[model samples]
Target: MNDLTKIMVSKGGTPADITVGDALEYRAALQEHHAQSAGHTLFYAWLRRLGSLPDDAPATLRNPSRATGQVGIEQLVDRCDLTCRPVRDLMVDYLTERRPGLDYPNAGQRPRSLS
Candidate 1:
């Protein structure tokens, strides 16, 4: 990835008040929770990552806040230049959000796409 994206990805760790494991676990929960739903999870995550989210983005892209997406977007933007994380990571996040019959907590609305 480009230097800018590296900077972005580096910022996604847990807050000073939280541990790394805690932050990862929380992100895992969000990914899994959203996965329970059918359709559009990946797309929503991508929109969140791109900062072009719709008003409903929070619910759909729960757990990781805009901060997460900002970091991800930075990574992606850098990646877009140097291919840091594969475009597939975005697709992966979207696909991982499939929980099928599981009930998802309110993550807020899904953000719309920039493209």
Candidate 2:
């Protein structure tokens, strides 16, 4: 990232002063605040519109869109594989339920086959 300067501007007879550290923090805080406010606003608005969705509604349907209400999770899974993650979870599970004699790191490494 490039270095940004904090400018002290004279706006409408008022002098605004900010330091370098203040500018970076202000930018990040502003972005995070926007994201949180948007999430809260959208959640309440959608909840007010649609009382409560049934269990059959897919995960993708969590967000309300302009198209249709019947779009389910199967379509989402078909369009995009949401489970394409690293083998960290499988490694954790294996480590949790490992036998003492088995050499997990050097020898047999049994994991959930995603591919």
Candidate 3:
């Protein structure tokens, strides 16, 4: 909300004055500055509910990079730089088998542990 407030103030308006363009610009700024997904925020929904934004406005102000493909098990294993081909292949197979049971955070941690 602070970010929105700043934008609104800079534009010489209130929250009710925020537009879809403003929200999109904010999302882009977040992605460019933070170098990661902006995820979802309630401001868009709030603006829509207040009739400040169109009902057809997006539910999220997330970055398009949020839809990027997940890194593959092979890619994750390769980053570990295992010198032995057998060990590298085995680690990949292990991760592949375990991936179904693991959530994203746990799956991400597995590669770091390998290093």
Candidate 4:
């Protein structure tokens, strides 16, 4: 299989704190998490060699007050880049899953392509 597919399959499930921290920091955390959690034994071993996540890593860091809404945007764009899912669809799916009872305030407007 391809590298992206391998990575996707390895990720298994999304972490609860995936949406935490600054956009760039969150992405870094995700990369670290994915590398560590990969299902492939070799991939997991490789990550282990890279060392464990820092105690202060942003993934589990609690700083919601600093959230700029850019975290989700960056994740969506990255997922779309990997999976080739349309940005609008991924945005809808993310909102639906992350905040099930609430609707996105900007839902009335069409989403822009991440291309």
Task: Give the candidate order by descending TM-score.
Answer: 3, 1, 2, 4
Model 2, C-alpha of 84: deviation from truth (Å): 18
lDDT of 4 by residue, 68-99 (tens): 33455455456555555575666767765655
TM-score of 1: 0.18
Q: List the candidate numbers ranked by lDDT, top first.
A: 3, 1, 4, 2
TM-score per candidate: 0.18, 0.17, 0.46, 0.17
The model with the greatest TM-score is 3
| Model 2 alpha-carbon drift over 4 Å, by segment | 1-16, 35-115
Every candidate's lDDT: 0.43, 0.36, 0.69, 0.42
TM for candidate 2 is 0.17
lDDT of 2 by residue, 37-88 (tens): 2332232223234534334333332333423453433443344544644444
Clash numbers, per candidate: 20, 0, 0, 0
Tens-place lDDT per residue, model 1, 12-88, is 53222223233345446546887443332454444345555444435453454553343543444454564545765
Which candidate model has the greater lDDT, 2 or 3?
3
* Residue 60, model 1: Cα distance from true site in angstroms: 21
